[model samples]
Target chain A: MNAIEIKGLQKNYGDFKLGPIDLTLPEGCIMGLIGENGAGKSTTIKAMLDMITAGGSIRLLGKDARESSALLKQDLGIVPDEIGLPEGLNIRQVEKIMADSFRNWDSKQFYDYMKRFNLPEKKAFKTFSKGMKMKLGIAIALSHKAKLLILDEPTSGLDPLVRDEIVGILNDFTREESHSILISSHIVSDLEKICDYIAFLHKGKLMLCDEKDRLLERYGLLQTTPEILRDLDASAVLGKRVTDYGAEAIVARDKVPQSFEIQPVSIEELFIIMAKEA
Target chain B: MKGLLKKEWYAFLQKPVTFLFPLALFVVLAIQTKSQVILMYLPLYFGILPVTLMSADEVSHWERYMHGLPYSRSAIVSEKYVTVLILSVFSMLVSGVLLFFFMNTGFAVPQFLFLIAAAFAASVLLPSVMLPLNLRFGAAKARIALGVIFAIFGCLAALSVDDEGGSRFQLLEKLAGLNISIGALTGILFAAAAVIMAASWCIALMLYRKKQF
Candidate 1:
């Protein structure tokens, strides 16, 4: 069964509009939402979580997200970009509060994550550094026996070592096949490392959605003279950038001539090219 | 609901010294003055506890965090009301003890029950007026709005004093002269405050439901 299904989701904020987005994630797969700062990544996540009123349908675990029973949320975990731990409380206090909150709260797992993350249990959240705060948020999201994890920029501002640690933990989380994750991040490298599926959002619109490996296999960066680019099939070009030195364009590798130099295109480069074209 | 209450408790603990300082000061004043009337204001000071908790919630964006949890919006709104009531009742108890001490010391606790009821009414009324504002406009904006509201009330009060050609003391005297017995007046004020609080809870719930965060 699909872990999440969104159809015709849209949010309007006067001059800005985000949506008509459709997405689905099968259980056990990790889907990464990549977008620019104001590209509606957080808005889409909020709508799916029912944190805001939105105009469309969203289903989680085959139940309408808006209509699901509160108990149904026991299997869902969330971590926003900014850690929401109360400034007054320490990790110990948060544990107690969370224990009371979720029926499925695992105290053992909570302590384990705290230990693994090396978070000082007695330190007030306000005193923790930015990376520590993010780690604590992840610990809370994982402590519950959640079947699905929804995270927004959980690792956007962390040291490389910590980012690697977080990515490893998330990769381990999906081993059970019953667990799925939908995460949003502007850090393309992080998403490329762990996400099975990738969705690109631009200015509130979905630009593309495809399997990561398949997308990488299908597209290549072609650098050639502008005169040669003009002769190349326009239908195969996804986006193009013309430079004084040469013209670089993204095209289906299968359709492009083998004689042209094809360079590797990272997801970030692909997004920048498309966004620039848009 | 239990977790929500626990979160508020942790919020209060952020500055445990601040919470205890006011209570201790009020208790000391009641003892030093050797007066039952002084004890009544204890509840009014305790009124700040809910406001403090509200600010703490805002400090870390805890309200937005709550949306991710399984809690319903109504439950979130109801918890603040419950917290205020708890503070009010606890303060009333402490004041009652201080009043008892004055009675034993021959300080003459006149109209004791009425004074206690008035304290409770004021405790409830202040939060009723403040929490909805805090929930709607947030702590900082709400505080500014509250200052404006109090300024307006203060102007009306000053105008009333000027029109009567009397000091604020005379206004107290006028209220003291109301024909009703102290018991009946206390009961009426308590009942009215309770009704206003109930209405305020409804208003706060509506405001919170419409709030994006």
Candidate 2:
């Protein structure tokens, strides 16, 4: 069964509209959702979790999210962009609270993660640094034995070392074949490192969704003359820019002539090209 | 639900020093007035305790976080009600004990019971009005809304006291002179407060269910 399935999900704010989005994440894989600020990454996650009343439907682990959300959440762990640990409580107190809050909360696992993260148990949450707060959140999220983990911008502002550590931990989390993850972030590099599949959301619409390998294989950075670009099939070109030396275009690697130079494309470059095209 | 309450319990500890303010005030008033009457106002202070806890929840944006947890919207709404009720009842019980020691020599037992019940009723009234407003508009906006409401009511109360003719206070004073027993009056007040609280809980649940965050 797929970990998450969203169909025709739509949410309309006065100034922005999200969706008509349909995406699915099969069990035991990590899917990265990529978007710019205000591109509706968070909205899609919220809609799928039924946090907001959206226009369509969602299914998590084969059950309708809206109808059986509380039960479904037992197997779901989420780390939102902003951490919400009570400012007054120390990590020790927070442990007790989580222990009481989640029936399946594992105290030993929580303490183990805290030790692994090197988080001080006695320090109040208000006194902790931003990075420490994030580590604490990750520790709580990981300890719960969640089947499908959802994270939003989990590594946005952390230092490189911390980001690498978090990425490593997430990679380790998916070693269990039954576990799946749906993570959203603007940092394409982080997503590229850990994600099995990538989905690009541009202005609330999905630009593309495919396996990481397939996407990398399908699109290439092409440098060619404008005249040659016109001769090439219009459908083959996803986006183009006129440079001082020549015209740079993102084109289908398979559709271009053998003579045309093709370079590898990173997810960041792909997202920028697609966002500009939109 | 236990986990949510535990979370609030720590959040409740956030302002431990502030909790002493009311106790200090009560001590000073007790020394100055030498009357048990000061205990009656304890409900008003304790009622605001729940509102203060809600402010902590807002600062942490807990409502948004709770959506990711294994809690229903109704459970979230009811948590506040249950927590506030516990805090208010605890406050009333402490005041009742203090009232016992400071009771006037000639004051009857029925009047003392009425006083305690009235204090409890007053305690119920604040949360009953404030919880729905807080849930509907959020902590900051709800605080402002409550401030405006209190100011209007204060002004009306002052005007009624000054006018004296056909004022609600006068009606109440005249009722006190009637043949109704103190126990009966307390029962009526308690019953009315109970009805209002039950209705408020329902309204708050509905408002909270519709709230976006």
TM-score of chain B of each: 0.89, 0.88
TM-score of each: 0.93, 0.95
Which residue pairs overlap in candidate 2's backbone? A101-B3
TM-score of candidate 2 to 2 decimals: 0.95
Worst 10 residues of 1 chain A by lDDT: A66-75
The residue ranges of model 1 lying beyond 4 angstroms of the native Cα positions read A69-72, A254-264, B103-110, B162-164, B167-178
- Candidate 1 structure quality by residue, lDDT tens digits, A131-232: 899888888888888999999999887999889999999998999889999999999999999999999999999999988888888888988888888888
Native contacts kept (model 1): 0.60
Per-residue error for A109 in candidate 1, Å, reads: 0.7
Q: Pick by lDDT: which candidate is best?
A: 1
Could you report the DockQ of all the candidates, in the order they appear? Answer: 0.58, 0.71
